[model samples]
Target: MSSTRFTDALTRLVDALPEPDDFPSTARNRELTARVGTWLGACFLLAFLTGVWSHLAQLPDPVLPLPTRPVWLYRVTQGVHVAAGTAAVPLLLVKLWSVFPQLFRRPPAVRRAQVLDAAERLSVLVLVSSASFQLVSGLANSAQWYPWSFSFRATHFAIGWVAMGALLVHVAVKLPVIRTAWLEPQGQPAQGTVSRRTVLGVTWAAAAVAVVTTAASGVPGVRRLSVLATRTGTGPGGIPVNKTAAAAGVARAAADPAFALVVAWGDTERRLSRADLEAMPQTTATLPIACVEGWSASGVWGGVRVADLVDLVGAPTGSAVLVESLQRVGASSRSRLPGNVAADREAILALTLAGEPLSLDHGYPCRVIAPNRPGALQTKWVSRLEVRP
Candidate 1:
């Protein structure tokens, strides 16, 4: 029968591929895979947690506000996020290569086992595809390039959840193998083309090289050394800008002499001009503007303390404030500052960056300079402050 012959040929094709049992089950292969996988898993966990924090912080009404005290919190987390993701490129390649031999492994013969095996393979495919997209897009974003039309944040965030979920499923499916491999006593690495030590040493060196090259954006001394470092150089006053005044369409209003910062509370309100703000006791704070795009710059900012501005309007001791920007559009044109950011003395409505008046590109007139907050949330060309909470 034609149908029976077709089934027989298909079965033959499946049997032709190497079985899983055919791959060398040496102590070295399992050990190497386990170690590399363990490191990769850790990187994913850190990137996910930090990413969630970033997402929540950017929300209009955050259920939980991130702390403002550490000052370098956002800077460190974002730096680590990029760094870990960068390191993953090489780690992933090595991991895939280590397991590539199993790709030829044949599927289960039993009906029940075949179904479970199919599911496991599907999970692995999802994990690999999502993770690959994340790394590619993340690196491309670092270079400020976009080849796709979709919203990077939304797409990446959704894929991140998918990737992590798939990763968990993959782990669950492989746990038995992982457990047995881990528990087995250390033994002489089975003879192979290369020693296990050599493979491990090369992998570690490759990852380290990748990290060091891309870390130039964060380390001043290595800036010249790291050509791959995406963010290098300054905007104005040696500080960087993610969105320029012209780009945000705030050039006209930002330069208008009639512009006054409107600060309001339930029953009290104050309109402070450039002079009024300058006349106030200016406090200085050093803060880094860390962007979600994986770039950052630091500068000395001097301006009215956030608490002092809140006090003028008679807001409660720890009232949350909504900051409005002169920019005409964009979701980040306005931002909400939780009580923690409002209460910090180091958090200021900055008029100047690095001793000079804020360059138009650097949020001219005034901008929020708070510790540990994302650069996008630091509303630029600040027009008004509403102490609603």
Candidate 2:
């Protein structure tokens, strides 16, 4: 058989499948569903674009490989991903409610034709199921819980591709009807349409309010806006006490090295200890420590500007600075230095928390604070610094 003939045959086979017309009341429900779906699609597209851009920007040099991207970019994009996914929850629910009745519609024909129709419907079901799971699991992961054994990030990424593929197929199949619907008004009763508008307006307003409230709650002037307070516990630093127990708590055995300010000139290295650092002029700033896990705290940090530190040590510009943690072993632990230190100017070896010595869990002896990065990148337990070209 010719290729054209085979293609025509397949087209005919699919065209013979039964059509189901049990679409729900085209009243207010349909209009609301359309609006909600449009909003969600727009949000998802924005989030997708931002995420792709951030990932591309943080790509490491081809010569070196890292398990994750640089800390600052990763923190920003991860927050964006979580926030966008979280907002999609109610939008999706409203969309689903409007189209749910279509699930039980009866077909126009029976036999093999009906089987193909059912298969098409099944594809939609799979898309909805997988997308729903992805959203819920993502939300849970943001809350710092992993109920399933599988990695949420990896699984979520995989399922997102499947869902997008299925969605594209679905839209292709429905292009004609969708275009018609787009061109024509839903013709819902005026009162019903008004009610839907009210509902949607309220929903969007509430969502905006929630986001602003949550953000303000983290700041010192507006911390009251957030319902949850920052959590405190014995963290990685294990300071204000014994260094041995702190290392034991996080399951590491590392010596607590004295704080040092170092400068390298060609082959020779010059070093200044903690007393030398304290002898320099100091500046303090109050900032909030916001964790990706949805908890935040405010602290007053007193430290020399990282630029000042470099200058005091007489290090050259564009040099790499390594910030190590005394509370953990190896560079991979919570003590690990940030991946992109040269790009940031505000990175500091912090010495005080809320105007006092650092707390045990808060990196007691000394910690590195890089603004706008996740808590994970903020290494606790200061030990060493290596300046390099």
Candidate 3:
């Protein structure tokens, strides 16, 4: 069929669907849609910023070395990413429902108006799809479910860029209408059963409840309030571990009586048993393993400073190191630590957690715990440290 005929057929099919007398739409309340759009835009912006920060932290070469101080930085930022995303769900649904009628609106009489209107519709489609994928997959990642074949980290990060770009285009397209709506005074009760303000208030309240419930994953002090929190932040030794030694196939190696951490630096190397590691000068630092899964907890990690180990093998300060885990498989089995992480006094190959021996899953003998790093990069069951000049 010809393009015009095909378009008309699709339009007829769409219009045939029975829309209710009180169906939500922009025609019902343009001001309400604009307000929800504003709120939705803020949530997307916050989620993108915090998501980028998190992506950077996990990189082998950070955009800039993340700070070792204010130790709770990653926790708070990732919490905000998840919380903002959770809140955006309600806003996006409300905004889409409010604009439902626009999908079937008659085309503009003028050709220029028609073209601009079509472009706006396309942008909105891209925005809705991208934003929906982000929020849905993000929540799935939190639950540790792998329903798709694609890598969550790579796909999620790639789509985040697209979603933000579409969001910017959407905001620019609607700037005039948004500005006018913001400046106008609230409308008086429309002499209807319920007011628009009342609907908006209920939406905001639901979003607030979502934030409070899911926020426990990041904020330890509010753990009691987060009914939806997946990782409770408390486990064998005051922290939850994603993969157990048995799960990671590290139980045998980790429990070996001959287990020792081999530290290498250029021409020199040192092998130390559990006792030898403990014998070395041990200092304690409080750090949080702010995971991408969106849960974190602070633990008193006591062990040799990573810099101390680097120095032991005669490696000068600021040398990057390779951390090798006993686990045979997994993307993070052998993670590369940037020089800044190795030199940080706070970074350690921790032996004790919360004054108790490290759990097998938490890296029994020794594990790399660096500041401002993602939990996955916190290589557990570390058996070898290859220092680079």
Q: Which prediction has the highest lDDT against the true structure?
A: 3
Residue 90 CA displacement from its true place in model 1, Å: 0.8
- TM-score: the better of candidates 2 and 3: 3
- Which of the two, 1 or 3, has more lDDT? 3
- Evaluated against the true structure, the overall lDDT of model 2 is 0.56
lDDT of 1 by residue, 131-206 (tens): 8998998888878799999989889999999989998888887888778767883665666667666777888898
Give the poorly placed runs of model 1, Cα more than 4 Å off: 1-28, 185-191
lDDT of 3 by residue, 210-235 (tens): 88887555665678888887866688
TM-score of each: 0.90, 0.65, 0.93
Local distance difference test values of all predictions, in order: 0.84, 0.56, 0.85
Per-residue error (Å), model 2, residue 61: 6.1
- Kindly provide the TM-score of model 3 when superposed on the true structure, using C-alpha atoms: 0.93
lDDT of 2 by residue, 150-189 (tens): 9654576667767667767766765565555567646655
* Clash totals in order: 0, 2, 0
- Return the lDDT, model 3, position 85: 90
TM-score of 2: 0.65
Which whole-number lDDT from 0 to 100 does residue 135 have in model 2? 74
